[model samples]
Target: MKPSIPPPPTQEDEALIKDYLLHRMLQTVLERDIQIFKTLELTMTNLYILNLQHIIKRMSDPYWTVKHQIRQRGIRIESKSWTPEGEIQVLYLCRGYQRSLLCSWPPMKEELKDRIISYLGTDLAAY
Candidate 1:
């Protein structure tokens, strides 16, 4: 006797999967960005100056390569017929926000950045 193959997902199932994946992806991207920002705050400050553009430029290759790998994984998931659209749009949105957060001059609001830096300073000092 031959082994049975599972039935293809229904349209509803596909839509649910896509939505869930998009939500998870967005959450992951936000978490990663926060971590990156914290790391930069801890490492990139000199006196009172923070050259975020230079830091982002130096970090872009590895950052984008990881994102590309994530997209490739999504493609692989699509090939497996799990999610129909593969959440590519969600990835693009996440990428846009990442650029806005890291590549923009002065990056984010000074108060928010200062809060992050202060949190990091205290956190590291605890170690």
Candidate 2:
């Protein structure tokens, strides 16, 4: 039998991991079609856990919650759906009129784009 593989972090590594997680999460939110105003509250524990299996076993399935900055000043959306790509649960702030930003992600179908436009609001150039 082969020796066991070591996990990524030691007990002492939590702080650096936590800081990196915060910065990355915020950056990811900002770089997307969403613009979050400020981060009022953030709990970094398990913030970067990408695997849904472990989340389903130990915690709530599709586990993620943003109560501080994102909810107070921005948008908070929660949904569970398995698309052709993968099962996903997403929470994000949406740009009500960012057209180019909408195209930045994977190319959505025209129907999807029209639906998104309807949901987000009109294509006002003022934004």
Predicted model with the maximum lDDT: 1
Off by over 4 Å in 2: 1-65, 87-127
* Each candidate: RMSD: 13.8, 20.1
Write the residue-wise lDDT of candidate 2 on 1-127 in tens digits.
Answer: 9977434333223222222233333334333422232232336323423222232333222123323333333332333233555422233323221111111123223433443344345684567
What lDDT score belongs to each candidate, Candidate 1 first? Answer: 0.38, 0.32
lDDT of 1 by residue, 1-127 (tens): 9977544334433344343443343345445665566656554444223333334344456456544554533322322122343313322222122211111213223433443444334464556
lDDT of 2 at 42: 38
Q: How close is candidate 1 to the true structure, as a TM-score?
A: 0.28
Compute the lDDT for candidate 2: 0.32
Per-candidate TM-scores read: 0.28, 0.21
> How many residue pairs collide in each prediction?
0, 0
**Clash pairs for candidate 2:** none
Instruction: In angstroms, give how far residue 98 of model 2 lies from its true place.
Output: 8.7
In the predicted model 1, the residue pairs found to clash are none
